[model samples]
Target chain A: MLLLGKNTQKSVLIAGLAACLLAAPAQAEEIWVSNEKDDTISVIDVATMEVIRTLPTGERPRGIVFSHDYSVLYICASDSDTVQVMDPVSGEILHDLPSGEDPEQFVLHPDNRHLYIANEDDAITTVVDVVTRTVVAQIDVGIEPEGMAVSPDGKYVITTSETTNMAHWIDTQTQELVANTLVDSRPRHAEFTKNGTQLWVSAEIGGTLSVFDVETKAKEVTLEFAVKGVHPDRVQPVGFEFTEDEKTAFVALGPANHVAVVNADTYEVEEYILVGRRVWHMAFNADKSLLFTTNGVSGDVTVIDVASRKAIKTIKVGRFPWGAALRP
Target chain B: MFLRTVLALCLSASAATADVSVVIHYLRQDIEQPPVLSNLDPIPEDLGLRGAELALKENTTTGRFLGQTYTMEVTHVPPGGDLPAAARSALALTDLIVLDAPAEALLAVADLPEAANALIFNASAPDDSLRGADCRANLLHSLPSNAMRTDALAQFLVQRRWDDLALIAGTHPDDIAFADALHGSLTKFGLRLRSEKTWAFDADMRRTASQEVPLFTQDLRDHDILLIADEIHDFGRYIAYNTWDPRPVAGSEGLVPVTWSHVVEQWGAAQLQSRFDKLADRPMRSRDYAAWAAVRSIGEAVTRTGSGDTAALRTFLLGPDFELAGFKGRPMSYRNWNGQLRQPIPLVTDRALVAQAPLEGFLHQTSELDTLGQDRPESACTAF
Candidate 1:
């Protein structure tokens, strides 16, 4: 280390301050959301409930998923028929992956090696190898296959058929049909219980949540709520997330414009938070302390305190927000 | 004996051919009866029938080419009356039927065998489900879909940068659907709802009236707009002047989204409005515009095909270039994909219709009119 003059010391001090600012721990995890109508992704700092950055994506991006280790994010451009891979840190498009016709939603495998794309118009789920960005397999489901999810064990994949009112289970290993369960009309999103024993299917038209036993493929319970027609005939429960302890699950009721907070153990609705009109999808912070829901109709993302189940603040996002994911 | 036999054959043929007539059967309750019609201030009854008259006139003008004439046999069925039998009897002689009935009555008519060949034009009942899940192949809607109207208002609000909305809805069957359409539009165009308040329909009219008396107050300052969905035309009017906060009202009443307006003079609307006023002796309203579109669509079908055959007319009406030079900007035609008519609706303020969209700037990647209602991307009607 050489001794420096006053000007040099000033420059060093400035560099040190810049380093400190860069090194300081980020206070909150960011939830990345793709707005279908606006063609932009809103990066929301979970702690402050503020939009830190809005990353532009391809036309009409609907589905979104974070890469393993949360380095990259993939969004399904329904209009563009391509999966947009973006670096979440820089909010830049890293690469584009070809997908099936009219991709609406995506589900990532536990190993993070494969991605399942729900091709809405084609009514098929196309499995794409993440690293290769190649379509590996395509399995037919039903008319307008919308929401998709991967099982905890990464052994199975499930998709909701909007018009067919059914949930399809596919064996991820063989890329074959596992089971077909007839659900309520316009079944939208499917979410597995934290323990991975049960699955909850939200029916947009039927306005009821169907709980099915995954292993035995048996119908368990249909969770009914007080609000009728609050969600359009399309209960369109688009996005769902569970608390860290797996004690609670929050379901975003699409056209119903409300969030159903379900107690995981009791399987009862702990509370219904009226967030905004046409609430589509939701995301949870890394710590699972807060839940963020995108209200498509209201063009705002509502932040809910997980413990209190109360809406803390609503940050205005782009038009018609469909999907959201968190940056670890 | 041969002459007598030929005479008998001629008589039998004459008996088989009934007089060509089109029956207009509607539910008595659904139709604004004399009392309700009398109560309609600021809107005229003949204005309500302007579309019907224009359609009939167009038919009469072009009927000479087809060697057949058209006539409207207006029949009002009392509430809960048997409409199917009445419609069947009418369908035997009538080539077309225009219905302004409730959803149940429309469904009942649709279920009839005679209604198969006879085209049914729904003038009211803007419920979107009738176009979506409960869509009837035989039925074609002339009235703008609920989504269309809501989208009109939403587009207008969006262009004005009125992003925040406070929605107030009345407790009515149509009101709920209207609200849903409004909500759909708001979401589609990226508008935020600040607060939503529900008012009871059966609640004291006086109280409700006073509740909306101060319509625009400071409390409403947070909202850029107030959307009121009162199809009953009761509460929404009050909301205009009496909101506890001050905000412009949009929806059923104040700033209404309609297919045609008396104030709409642009794009040959003035000529149509004048023609309608001359023919119907009343100022044009939305219902009149829809009714006119229904008649005009049928007339255009007949004119283009130059045949009274229902199948030929239906095919022509469903085809592109079957345009109606109605009051709306540009000629209107059905989407063919869903039988939804694509027309520009007027977003009217109290003084005058403020904006119209598919406005000049708002262009659809497809047909510009496609931007007016549900885009093809999210449309549930897959069967074109």
Candidate 2:
């Protein structure tokens, strides 16, 4: 009778959590732009499409991410080699955490206690304690490790090596290399499925997106871009977000100046929305109604309607703007 | 046990006796005769020898399993020496020879009776005729042809959208040939020659100082690029700083096309440059890369084929399967049609090396690298 009661209580708790998640807002409503050359972050009021405020940060701030609670902002200062923690509401830097040399991009751990930084020139990933602002460990990676993403379960971290033409997986707990799988020439960025079953890698030189099975570590499919002579150097599949129903993945192609809408189930490119030159990172609204992309070379931000997959407006920004986050 | 030991001893003795040895006749020509260009640096006597040393190092590290060894016999021929006799002496010693001789001397050596079976490589000349109408079946060109270098420059200019060019030529015969090659490339790439001017060489200074004449008072302002052809190096540097217009310059001087540059630090260049500098006590020039690539090619051939036999090495080198790491980005191979070593060329400026052709974006239908030089469709020579 006591064992039966315990099982009933566990099921009730899971059901309550599921109900809460379903009732939560479906999208992020406001957009935050990290302007690298301007050394400021532009807060866009999504409804009115106006610049709410421009907050100043460190020199050459490039990569950015918001906390899971949407309270703190993390910005990677590439030239400074530090991740600046900021209070998003007050537009103030709360603290600074030392990262590896030339930290280009980073991802948050599932537990929200650790951050993994892809230190570009140092060829290593630096793990930092979020609350303490201390570096816990350094994981040696390949040459020019750039874009990174943590698995959904937070059990592994995947990083792309630009020159070495391989993607490496590291154990989250031990920070040891678990696998070094060759994907394509000049693999740039990686993304994992929502269920953590498969990982998709973009090859800059080979001009193809390679999909690998998470367990077997074998390539399952390759999605080739239609553009020729494009010199896919930076297939930056950055700022990935699912649709309202979690059926589609919106991928931003930096140099190709297009956004690829991919079918989440079939692993096929559904549509490509053209944007400004060197379109980089992207963000979405709270209701999943609008998507904002930072165009690096064109010095603008493209606002796209998620349903139409068409750019509705472009707002001018600072030079070489990259990274975008959203706040409700 | 005693019988087994005796059998082992006999096997070791036979293996030692079966070792193969081959000799390479390195024929070095001293073309520094009277009437030599005064401003140019004298060709170093050990240029080819330095290349041979690097090649030998690579071979010993990777080619020892082939059961063959390489040794060179250098015969330095002064100006007006008996070419046939020198070649015959080299042929008697070794079946393979690397020749650094002038056009006339090359022709004379090619006419030798013993030159038919012996393999000869031209390591110095840039003349395209040696691979064209005057092509010899026995000769292989390790140095790039004049057409190849000009094509490299022309492709770079086209990529940069500099289509209008001002042609500056010198009166020397070699300069004329260089100009012809550049003109052919410009025309082939659809670039317009806005004007052509002659920069007559001055005997007193051994330089082309004709820039003071102001030949481009009207036409110079119209051109998008300045193309200079001064083989003696006297006037090219002056042309760069004193071009009529502020437009970018390309050709022999400004944004020059070269096989290699000391300033190149991309890919595997840093290690090769350091190795060459440590050995030669000076920075490596374009000539050094060509010479180094030639010897390295031989090493690769032997290593890949697992044999140092001259005929076998030659066959493997000429085959499509052979590829050598020439410090360039891609594997270097030979153009089967003309026996030209086809490799990526570097485009350099005075303060910085700007770009490389077969630049990142340019693409060919078959191979992206084919855009850098004469494509197979335009190649005249039929022999592979």
Candidate 3:
């Protein structure tokens, strides 16, 4: 069930403000990047394209996400095996949640209170409730679960295990696996479509993306990317995001060092925009006018202009940056 | 989790028979080594065997869900023991054999008539001949060959534009073989060997390392990097700072190209380290990883093909569809031509991963991993 809370109201207000400020471009949002090696978060002001602040985090922070209302942030400090809740405004850590071992990536359900975390070492998906800071359920999953995602309808959550090569689907209401869908070797990330009809899973080592019919849990398509002058082994597809209208998708090809613009309707690659080395994940600005990619090898974020399809600026961050999220 | 998986299997088995049964035989013969000069710990006694054990545990965990039973029988031959006879008996029981033996012993067992339907994994020997003229159809190599290690170093050197190199090789047989392998890569990468020397001193290195090393390398030609080829973990540790020209030492010493290292903490490897450490109580080594991969390959083949038939498993392993999550950032697959597992070689120092090869811009027509070792065109074996 979707919450009729300030999160929804704030999104509407942010969208309206984005539209009005499109011409002048004075207001600012922040692209927060999690540095896996340095244990820091580099906050980049959208207006200036510069790193505004570098805040300390728990050891080896990898995955990061903002609350829907843009009030707080969740950082997965992987090595510490705990999730830190931080006030984005004050840059103060509120407290830590009981995340299982090696929490690499996670998803915030539409309800905004439940977080599904992927515990890589334990092979368990730990669902935590934010209000009580208590673990809701610890569901046993496949080996080496790395990526976590929730459906738009908030009915199911998916965990992509790197070793098991399967996407384990858990029914949110029951907190148990309803389906286990096989993907290619080493599935790294998964996401549902905006309409919640399709589930997209990226297999990092397989160098392909698997799309499934969400209702039937059957694979609909397998998408492969081939960047010119790049070897097939290096063309690893990881994190992905869609355009505002859901017509086009921008996928981060890990180690291939490029982002592929794809036609969502046809499932065809349109163009490859070169980025930094070993790009892991991405986050779009509030207006969808800018895409920021965290390059793990280069330790920087490559900001791409969404309309022009060109890299506008490179903002240096801490070492081995893994994930990016927008707070608008 | 294992208990849960087993419980689920018990519930499923009540309705159906356990269909898939896989039995593996693991063999090893640790050869004598020169006393290591450095103070670091020696290799673990269960180097290759513990890896096979870990893989067995993993296989059973996955097999529990798929209604399969997996087991591995281990036999470690004493040094200078009759390895071939022991291997013959081990091969008679099962077709899947994981071996950690010398090249001669592996070749001897591979040539056995009783091993006609068997698949053997070369998990210890880094010999190049096994990947070349003496290659066997039934044999698969999980360990990186000597050529792969040297080629990885060559790629890192080329990426750094370190063209001219000087070589200091120990007198051990493995050291000579590693140096021989490096010579081929230096020629292939168009790098110059400005000076080459073999260690001939008989003094105790701990007492006279600083005094003897500098004078030994003083007359050498100018070079950009110093290459040490001491595979026995013997004399190379003393050659780093004692080199006359202050060149960076690499190869088997300061900076190394390895199949697996404790320093590899990226790309889901940290979890693997934690898992292995939990099971073995120590960091995983190269041989352990190779042996683990060998056992897991069989497990993957049987799980995917849904049968214990040797031909089917072999076909699946050598096919293009085979992909193993090796925790090396790249999905590894066996080379169909020579049965060598294709993987990324990590170039590391003592405490950090410096880089992984093939480095940027080292492109290949097929796979970037193919550039590290013997490609199809250069491979001498007609066996697959």
DockQ of each: 0.01, 0.03, 0.24
Kindly list the per-residue Cα lDDT of model 1 for residues A1-328, writing each as its tens digit.
0000112332354356446647766535678888888999888877677888888999899888876555678889888888988887678898888788778888887777888888876657888888977888887665567768777777878887664445777887778765666565556688776457888787654567888888776777877665543322234455667665667778887656789888877878878887987887787775567778888878999988888889989899899877887665
* Docking verdict class for candidate 2: incorrect
Best by TM-score: 3
Candidate 2 structure quality by residue, lDDT tens digits, B312-350 = 877777787666656565556666666777777788986
Superposed model 1: Cα runs more than 4 Å off: A1-28, A228-236, B1-384
**CA-lDDT, candidates in order:** 0.70, 0.69, 0.85
- List CA RMSD, all candidates: 21.2, 11.4, 4.3
Candidate 3: CAPRI quality band: acceptable
Model 1's CAPRI class is incorrect
Q: Look at candidate 3 and give me any clashing residue pairs.
A: none
For this target, which candidate reaches the highest lDDT against the unseen true structure? 3
- Report clashes for each candidate as comma-separated counts: 23, 4, 0
lDDT tens digits, residues A198-277, model 2?
Answer: 78787654556777888876777877665443443334444455665557877777667888888877878888888887
Model 1 Cα shift for residue B314 (angstroms): 28
The reply for model 3, stretches above 4 Å from the true place, is: A1-28, B1-19, B36-39, B60-65, B203-209
Interface RMSD of 3: 6.5
lDDT of 3 by residue, B1-384 (tens): 211221222222111233798999998886776776666867788998888898887777566556678988989889999988998899778999999988999989989998888999999999988998999999999999999989999998888899999999989889999999999999999999999998866754445665788988998899999999988877788888887778889999999999999999887788888889999999999999999999989987876777899988999999988988898888899999999999889999989999998787777887788998899999998987
